[model samples]
Target: MTKGERAGADVAERAATGRAARDRLPIDGHGVFRPPADRADPVQIVFDQEADRLPDLLALRHRRMRASPLAFYRGAAAVMAADLAGQPDSGLRTQLCGDAHLFNFGLFASPERRLVFDLNDFDETCPGPFEWDLKRLLASVALAGRANGFGRRVRAGILSGAAQRYRTAMIRFAGEGELDVWYARADVDDLVTRLAKSRRRRVTRVGDKARARTTLQAYRKLTTVIDGRRRIVADPPLVVPVADLLPTVDRIALEDRIRTMLTGYRSTLAEDRRHLFDAFRFVDMARKVVGVGSVGTRCWIILLTARDDTDPLLLQVKEAGVSVLAGPDPVPDPDGEGHRVVAGQRLMQATGDIFLGWQRVPQLDGRTRDFYVRQLRDWKGSVAIDELTPRGLRTYAELCAWTLARAHARAGDRIAIAGYLGRRGRFDTALTEFAESYADQSERDHAAFRAATKS
Candidate 1:
């Protein structure tokens, strides 16, 4: 870091901030609801993305989307991205969790084993408009409320209340200095302490569930001994051993490919992370179907045994691809998709997995792919939004909004975004209006998705 480099960095940040300020000038508070007449068919976008995915698992992805509009929304980031592009944007780039839906926020263990809440999924993460992430989140609130059988009034209330929190939090962050904003976090302990008794109980229950989701529990649930060798159990389409899912040739080459990938992954880690990762010996791996949207994508769980057989570690290696947020205004990712994901996750999360890193490796057929690796089990758990009552939903919704604001504050131009979102309800109202309209589109998309899967 030379003086010239520091000056250049500061100037670049000011330019980005200037862009964000300009974005607000063109788009009125009510201008966010522009659903273009030529908005592409959501179903077609899903199908196009399916081209890079495992063909056999497409049915599972479709089935998941067919379950409900919220489920459909969860897997429809591409659709939303397309739709959002037609809407007014702030043009302020930030590290986006491209699919920042209701379900994407979750409880995960920090390195110290403390429960912390933040945006948990990042397969489609990239630098993009701050408004894009907020729109996705706001729409999810409406869709989740709909799935819970909430009326339009209640759904409207949820969106408004959540937007208020987001606005207020951003205002609060704007007052803080640079380092203060960067160090902010959503610690579960602090959250629980602020809640009423009933709400506290609910938070504790989710926290307990998160704590129970350890690597030991994952081992018991996903593995068994076969011929005196520990191996992942064959559970078709859900948690199948690699050999059971892939062709003989692909299965035969799996070990070597994984080894090489891990080697490259190790090289990407910081010295301490690499040192810790090097201690674990690769024991086995399995292709696992995970999440509603991620079903068709290549995701693997690799087992590693520490000093003794009882000491085990599980690492998840997920394929990274072009982000849904990337389009004509695509932000650059000079380091590659894997690096983009890793960087985005670190920027957005207050604390992240110690094993977080990336690798670019070619598969057996020789197609180079980017994969980001992290501990598969970090005591992660998500609430069932379908089961939340209106009151619970309201409480959960505010927390999510607050968390999203904190993430944006840390990664984007906090002062500019905070200023754009002043102390007012106009921006909030506009976003809620957009969310209601989009919820209807999601239902239509779900119906089409159901028909396509069955056909």
Candidate 2:
């Protein structure tokens, strides 16, 4: 047979796979959501995750989650995972940003030093049904729109439009060459050029802010000169220096241990990046409380300097745990949790930080934990969800949806997934309904969590 015939046969097989998925669970069936009779309590699920977290910081994590419903949702990936497990999916597996909420998509500097918008957080990243990520993203849009004081109708439109964007983008990706699809990225400059004059300033301002949030900027804000030595400032329960954290332990010994762990982490980077890392001398380290969900986890800001205190590099080493999306009989992953996050980030992102790496290190409690490391802040910024207008929310959702589809296409069978969605609005309609329903459920869960925390 000719090459043309072989290509046609391959397309036919892939399309058939997608069509067959509808039989397992019809497209419209996705709209349905009824909490199982024996569903686990959402609060309990979150509390269970705290088992391995820092005891003192658990209060801070709870406080952050209690700030608002969206805050609770940000920290409740485990809860959503349990709820999603009780539902049906398309069976099209992909590398999922397991917590693909709207807030998780943001702008960060690429290796080429250009601002690119993509999924920013990967703490829960793992291989799973592609629809799980889609559902999470849609639900987040609905929730965020509601938070922004948009009416139900407006939220519904945004959710459906976002889902449709995902479908259309996937279909487009299905028609592209492998390399073309892999190379596609959401460059911020191109996004700004496509936006209206009225909206361009807001996005441009966001980009500018991200660019200003460099390592040097962080050094000026988070460090102070103490007796001719630059050291991380102490901000109890928020940012505590290593010396303060281990008052009884010898400061030099602790610094040596941190350097040792980072040495192991450096081995994970490319030879060129390793050379780049070697130039900086470790000056100080601090335990920092960061993000709504990541508060209790072991997160450290390692301050390194080159020439003078002004020339600094801030590396954030965050703890890595088992993904909420991991199944009972999971796919064999050779690397530990830290590597899992690093691998997933590499798979989903067009370009990543040169300093991104992973290592398993012994903790202060004498237990070893997995950790992933990257710059603390390198041109990172996210839209203010609470400040967006209805139209802005819809546009942002579309951008996020398109980015997600591209990420999924890179890892999953795009032809089959696109074939499943077809050229109809059935999946879009169903997903919107699911988002509305899930948003209500999340509110109720947040209330329950708040009551539990208070008790």
Candidate 3:
């Protein structure tokens, strides 16, 4: 067998014997990421990140964050990354979502037109301990539950339920060959059918809403035909036309630059995909405000029309910066951030955006910024946590667990991780406790952030 095939064979043998001679880490130890008495100030970390983003949008980002502590935590992936530096790990690494909060899990269309549920965001994605993503996900559950005014016991139960499901799912995935695990997909319909009547109804509604978000709907809503020219409608802060953001002279030049970048982006696609992509003619481009954490970054929507004017496609190209997990101890990532985002995304997601590609654009100031491009809102949808009851949260948490385990298994040594997790409840219980305590810490940090920003 080839070396890689040999490695897989070795791992399969190890799993069959309960990871004989593998490093056996204690389950309880996953819970211990004790912040030094002098942990980094959360407010300062927020400002540090804000410094590199668009200036005017910082106010909007801060406003969104102040709405709730979970909102704050959603935008504070860097702060958590710094804190996770102190945590013990299984020594097994995977391409991390870096910000694997509950809100980041969503349903999106696969290339085959099937809707699949998986991790959605990848701006800060990079290689890190598998547990770091798990920890971040569990903590988000606690914070989100608290935001909905769920009781402490209810919130803790959500974390416990989620962790247990992750352990169970990992064990299941471990039993399969690596290639078999890689081919697995978490189809949204399969998920919906398995739920109770109440959740099934809710998920069905979500599917309906997602189905309605077609390219035609987007074009009709966001574009207008003026004379013979189709143009993106100016929508102020939310969806500003490129002309609104720059003078006429600069607008012409920037559009030219973007067109050139698109050429580079097209080259990044596979040969077969590039032939398909070439069929779409560029129509217009606009700056778009997107997401809680991604608020202040440079995000643009590119509209393309197929041979017929009625057929439309929307592509979103957003700036990619250094991953939050590119800390002192994590795997090094000094190359292209755009490639970093795309590689991690492809590694973790069962299926990915067909148009996904990366490019670096030169700025007016003689610098270049990395960016990754993908289809915009391809039947994309997320659960409304505030609308969910405590029981609904429990069900959703389990779904997140199943999805995350599949993602982690795709990138890391599934046999070793599953063996480290074992077929037990000890790790699950410890993680739930850790999540609850971390939620309390998040609230206090949120208060400090509010005060610091106010001052």
The TM-score obtained by model 2 is: 0.96
Tell me the whole-model lDDT of each prediction, alpha carbons only.
0.82, 0.89, 0.84
At residue 351, what lDDT does model 2 achieve?
Answer: 84
Tens digits of per-residue lDDT for model 2, 1-455: 22244356688788788889999778998995779889999999999989989999998899889887888999999999989988888887889999999889999999999999999899999988889999999988888888889999888888888999999999999999989999999999998998899899999999999999887888889999899889999999899998897765577787887789899999999999999899999999999998887878989999998887667899999998889888545564566689999999999988899999998877655777788999999999999989999999999999999999999988888888888998999999999999999889899999999999994
Deviation from truth (RMSD, Å), model 2: 2.7
Clashes of each: 0, 0, 0
Number of the top lDDT candidate: 2
lDDT of 2: 0.89
For candidate 3, the lDDT comes to 0.84
lDDT at residue 325 of model 1 (Cα atoms): 75
In model 3, the runs with Cα more than 4 Å from the true position are 1-9, 12-25, 328-335, 364-366
Ranking of candidates on TM-score, top first: 2, 3, 1
lDDT of 3 at 99: 90
- TM-score of each model, paired residue for residue: 0.93, 0.96, 0.94
lDDT of 1 by residue, 401-428 (tens): 8888899878776666766676667878
Worst 10 residues of 2 by lDDT: 1-10
**Steric clash pairs (candidate 3):** none
* lDDT digits (tens) for residues 214-331 of candidate 3: 7788888999987888889998788999978889998889888888888999998999999999999888899999999899888999988897778888899998888888885445
